[model samples]
Target: MIAIQALRAYNLFYFSLLSVFISFLPVYLSYRAVSPSDIGLLVGIGSFIGILSQPFWGMISDRRKTIKKVILLTLGLSLLVGFVLFQSSELWLLFLLVGGMYFFMLPTDPLTESLNYRVAEQYGIHFGSVRTFGAIGFASASLIIGFTVDQIGMDRLYWVFAVYGVLTYLMCLVIPDAPVSSKRLSAADLRRFLTYPATLRFFLLILLAAIPHRTNDSFLGVYVQSLGGSTGLIGLAWFVAATSEIAFFALLPRFLRTGREIKMIALASAIYVIRYALCAVVSDPMLVIAIQLMHGITFVTFYTASIQYLYRIIPEEWKATGQTVLAVIFFGISGIIGSFAGGWVFQEWGGAALYLMMAGIALLAFLYSILMWKREEREAETLAGEA
Candidate 1:
C-alpha cells in the first residue's frame, strides 16, 4: 500500500499533467484558426455547462460520500471527448471538444483537493508540502510542453492531451484507499451551507479575480510569441510563475500561515492588480516574465487561503460541494466571461488596455473582500449580543 503522502503527491503530479495540457487549450484553438470571440464562446459555454454540472456532481458526491464514482465517470467521459478530437477535425467539432473536455475535467481538481485535505488530516504530514509538488508538476509541464511545441510543431498537441488523459486514468487508480464519509450532513446543514451569505460573496470574489486572470490565460502565448518569444521563453515564463508560487508556499507556513484566510485572499486580490498591469505595459521580456513570477502570490497564496476558508465556512457534508462551487464560479463561469472579454480586448483594445481592465477588476475584488471581512465581523458581534 502506498503511504498516504505518496498517494497525495502522485495525485498532484497526475493532475498537473492534465493541467498543462488544458492550460494551452486556448492557444491550440487560436492556432486552428478559431476566432477570438468564438474561442471565448467555446471556453465560456463549456465553462457554463461545467458550472451547471458541478452542483449536480457535488450532490452526487455528497450522496455517495466518495467521489470515486464521479471521478471515474467524468474521466471516462473525458476519454471519449479526447478520442473524438482525433476522429474529427472540423471547426465545430473543435469548439465542441473544448467544452466537452472542460465539462469532464473541472471536477477533478476541486474534488481531489477535498480528498487531499482529508488525507492530510488523517495522516500527520504537511498538506502544503505534499500538494506543492503539484505546482511543480504544473510548472514543469508548462515549460516542457511549451518547449516541445516550439521544437516539434503544434500537430502533436491533441496527442499530448490524450496521452495525459490515459495516464491520468491510470493515476486515479492509486488514490489512497480512504473510507467514504458515512456521516452525511443533514438537510438542515446542507441548507445552511447553501444559504451562507459568505458563500455568495466568495463566489463573487472568484468572478472578479478570474476575470483578469483570464486575459493572461487566453493571450499570454500570442503576446509572448509576437514579442519575439520562442516556446522556450514561454515555458520559462510559466516556470518563473510556478517558482514564485513555490516560494510563497514555503513562506506560507509562517507569514499569513495561520488561519488568517481572509487576509490571504485579500492580499492576493491586491497583488493581481499589479501583476496583470505589468503584463500589459512591460516592453522587456524579462520584465514580463518577472510579472509571471507573481503567479506565486496570485494563485498559490489565493488558492490555499480559499481552500482553508471554504473548508472552515461550509457544512462538513458539503465539503466537496463547496469546493466545487468555487471552481464552477471561478474557472467555469468567470473564465468564460473573461475569455470572451479577453478576445475582444486583445484584438480591438490591445493587450495593454486588456491588462488595464483586468487591473480594475482586481480593485473591485479588493473592495468586495474588505466589505466581506467587515460583514463577518459585524455578524459575529450580532450573534454574541443574542447569546
Candidate 2:
C-alpha cells in the first residue's frame, strides 16, 4: 500500500538536506567575513518573514483544509527563492532572498507534522519511526556538507543549498496534498483559540525558553570552527548530535507519561547550563565536540515536548496559529536576537559570555517552569471545582 510512510521517508530525505544547509549556513556566512550584525540581519529578516508567513499559511490551511497545495506552492516559492539567493551580493538582495526562503520554508515543519499525525491516526505507523528518517538524513548530510566545506570552498555551498531547495520542491509532487479544511475559522473559533490562557502561557514559556535554547543551533558550527576545528569535525559533531537525536526520538514515544514532558524540558534546559559552560571553558577540540550530545535534549527533547504541548493545548482550528506562535516567538524572532547577541557576545565578552548568557537564560526558563506548574495546579483545581 502506498502509505503516509512514504511521506515520512520523504520528510527525512528533504529535511536531512535542510540539516546540511542549516548546519553550515552560519559558519559559511561567518567565514565570508560577513559582519555578525549583518549575519544577524540576514538571518533575522528570514526569521521575521518566516514567523509571519507560518500563521498566515496555517490559517489558510485551516480555512481551506487543503494542505497539499499549500505545501507544493510553498515549496515552489522557496525553490525560486533559493535560486534568487544565488544572484545576490547586495545586502538587501540577500535580505530579500532569505525572507523569501523563510516564507516558503517555514510551513514545511508544521504542515509536515500535521500530515504525519493524520497518517498515524489513520494508520498504525508511529510518528517517531518516521521522524527517525529525518535524523538519519541529518546525520548523513552533516558528513557530506562538512567534508565539502573543507574540500571545496564555502562560496560554492550556496549552489548546494539552492539545488537542494529545488529538489525539496520536487519532493512535494509525490506526496499527496495535506487534507485541507473547508470550514472557515469563525469568530467563536477564534475565541476558542484564545480561551486557553494556559496554552498561551505555555507558548510564551517555550518562546522565552527558546531564546537561549537555540543559541547553540545558531552558533555552534562556527563556534566549533573558531576553536580551530575543521568543518569536517564540525559536521561530525553535528552528525553525532543528530544521530543521538534520532535515538532519543526512537525511544521517546514509549516514555510519554504524565509530567514527563515538563521534566524532559526542565532537564534539557539544565543541561544547557553545563553544555554552554563547557563550550566556554573547554578549548580541546575533542572535548568541546563531545558536548554536542547535549543537542539530543536541547533540540529533540525541548522541541518534541513543545510541539506535543501545542498539539494538545491548541484548539483544532487554531492549531497552525499556535504552532506558528512558538515558531515566531522562540525559533524565528528569538533565534535571530540570540544569534546577533551570541555573535556580539563572542566578539565582546568572548566565548565564555555566550555560554554564560545561555546559562543565565536557561535558569530563567527553569523559574518559568516552576511558575507554569503553579498555574497548572490552579487550573486543575478550578476544573475540579467546576466538575
Candidate 3:
C-alpha cells in the first residue's frame, strides 16, 4: 500500500513537470524571440536525438538491471541542464541546451512506465489507477502555471519547472525498485523481437496515428495564441485536455477485461479524425479549448490500450525495451516528422491548414486500423478452432 502511494506521488510530480514542458515550452521559446520554424527545428532536433537515446537508455536500464538508478540519473541531469537552458535565449545555445535536456528527460516516460507496470503487477494494483495521478498532476499544473505565467511572465516558467523537477526527484528516491531480469538482451534477441509481425505492424500503426497528435502537441499553444488566446487560455486548454483523461484512466481496468484494446485504439484514431477536423474549422479560442475534451477518447484511450497491448506481447525480460520502442516510434520519430512538418505548414499555410492536413493523416490511420482489426479477429478464430 505504501509502495502504491509512492508510485502515485512519483507520477504526480513527474507529470507536473512534463505538463509544463510539453504544453508551454514553445510559448517560452516564443517569448524569447524564436521564430516558428526555428522552434519546430529545435523541438524536432531534440526528438531526433531521442530516437537514438530513448532506446539506448532503455538498453542500459535493462542491461544494468537498475531502473531506479537510470531514472535518478536522468532527472538529475535534466535539472542541471535545464538551469542553463532557462538562462539563455540565443537560438544556437537554446538548441544545444534543449537537446541536452531532452536526451535525459524524454526517456523518463517509458522508464517510469516500465517500473510502474511491473510494480503494479507485483502488487495486484491497476496500472491506470497509478497513472491517473499523473493526469491530475498535469491538469492541475497546467492551470496553475498558465495563470501564473499570465500574471507574472514566461520567464518564470523555468523556475516553476525546476521546482516540479525537484519534487519528482525526491519522490523517486522513496519508490521501491523494480525487479530486473538475470539475462541481458543481445543483438540477436533485439533482432528477433523486431522481426515479429505484430511488433512491426504495431509500430507502423503508431507512426501513422501519431502524426496529427504530435503536431497538435508541438503547436497547439502557438495556434491558440494566433487565434487571440492568452497564455492562461492555453494553459486552460491543456488543463481541460489532461483532466478529461482522469475518468478514462479510472475506468480503464473495467474495459481492459473486454479484450477490445485494439478496437479501442481504432476508435481513438477515428476520434482524432473528427477532433482535428473540428480544430481546423473552429474560430473561437474558447471553442478550441472546449474541443480538447476529446483528448479523453483520443490520446487517453490510445495510450492506455497501447501500453496494455505492449505488455501482453513483450517478454518480461525485455519490458523496458518494449516500452522504449513504442516511445521511440510515437514520440521520437513521429515527433520529428510532426514538429518539422507542423512548423513548415504553420509558416506556409497556417494552423487551420496544418490541422486539415492532419485530418488526412488520421483518415489513413483509421483505414489501416480496420484492416488490422480484421486480421486480429481472424487470428483469434484460427487459434480457437485449433483449441
Candidate 4:
C-alpha cells in the first residue's frame, strides 16, 4: 500500500517536471538568444543520443538488479547538467549540456514504469489508476506554470524545473524496490528476444503510428497560431488533451478485464484517423482545440493498451529493457523522423497537407491492426477446434 502511494506520488512529480521541461525549455533557450534552428538541432541531437542511452540504462538496471540506483544516478546527473546548462550561452556548450541532460532524463520514464508496474502487481493496484496522477500532474503543471512564467520570466524556468526535480528525487527515495533476476541476458538471449515475431510486429506498428502522432504533438501549437489563435488558446488546447487522459486511465482496468487490448489499440488507431483528418480540414482554432479532446481516445487509450500488451508479452527479467525499447522507438527514432519530415511537409505544403498526411498514416495503421486482429482470432479458433 505504501509502495503504491509512493509510485503515485513519483508519477505525479516526475510528469509535472516533464511537462515543465518539454513545454518551457525551448522558450528558455529562445530567451538565452538561441536561434530557432539551433534549438531544433539541440533537441534533435538530444533525442538521437537518447535512443542509445535509454536501452543502455535499462540494460544496466536489468543486469545490476538495481533500478533505484540507476534512477538516482541519472536524475542526479540531469539536475547537475541542467544547472550548468543555464549558465552557458555558447552553442557547443549548450549542445553538450542538453545531450547530457537527455541521456539521463530519457531513461527515467521506462525505469519508473518498470518499477511502478512491479510495485502495482505486488500491491494489487491498477497501473492505470496510478498513471492517472501523471496526467493530472501534467495538465495542472502546464496550466499553472504558463501563468507563472507569464509573471516571471522565461529565464527563471530552470529554477522551477530544478524544484520539481528535487521533489521527484525525494519521491524516489520511498518507492519500494522491485525484484530482479540473478541471471543476466546472454548475447543469444538478446538476439532471440529481438527476433520474436510479436515483438517485431508490435514495434513496427508503433513506429508507423507514432510518426504522425509525434508530428502532431510537436507542431500543434504552431498549427493553432497559424489559425490566429493566441498563446492562451494553445495552452487551453494542450490542457484539454492532457486532462482527457484522466477518465480513460481511470477506466482502463475495466477494459483490461475484457481481454481485448489489441482491439482497443485498433479502435484508438481508428480514432486517430478521424482526429487528424479533422485537424487537416478545420479552419477555426476553437474547432482545432475541440479536436484535441480526441486525445482521450487516441493517445490515452492507445497508451494504456500498449502498456498492458507489453507487460503481457515481455518476460519478467527483461521488463525494463522492453519498455526502454518502446521508448527508443517512439521518442527516439520515430520522433526524429516525424520532426524533420513533418517540418518539411508543413514548410512545403501547409498545415492542412501535413495533417492529411498524418491521417493517411493512421489509416494505414488502422487497416494493419484490423488484419492482425482477424488473424489472431482465426488462430484462436483453429486451436480450439483442434482441442
> In lDDT terms, which candidate is top?
3
lDDT per residue as tens, model 2, 264-321: 6776767767777777788876677788887776777777777776677666666655
Cα RMSD for predicted model 2: 2.4
* Per-model CA lDDT versus the true structure: 0.73, 0.72, 0.89, 0.79
Tens digits of per-residue lDDT for model 3 on 13-57?
999988877898788898898888888999999999998889999
Task: List candidate 4 segments past 4 Å from native.
Answer: 26-41, 84-91, 182-184
Task: For each of the candidates, give the backbone clash count.
Answer: 1, 6, 0, 0
Task: Show model 3 residue runs off by greater than 4 Å.
Answer: none
Per-prediction TM-score, please? 0.91, 0.90, 0.98, 0.91
Q: 161 in model 4: Cα distance from truth in Å?
A: 1.3
* Best first by TM-score, ranked: 3, 4, 1, 2
lDDT of residue 192 for candidate 3: 81
Worst 10 residues of 1 by lDDT: 14-23
RMSD of 1: 2.5
Candidate 1 matches the true fold with a TM-score of 0.91
Give candidates' CA RMSD values in order.
2.5, 2.4, 1.2, 2.3
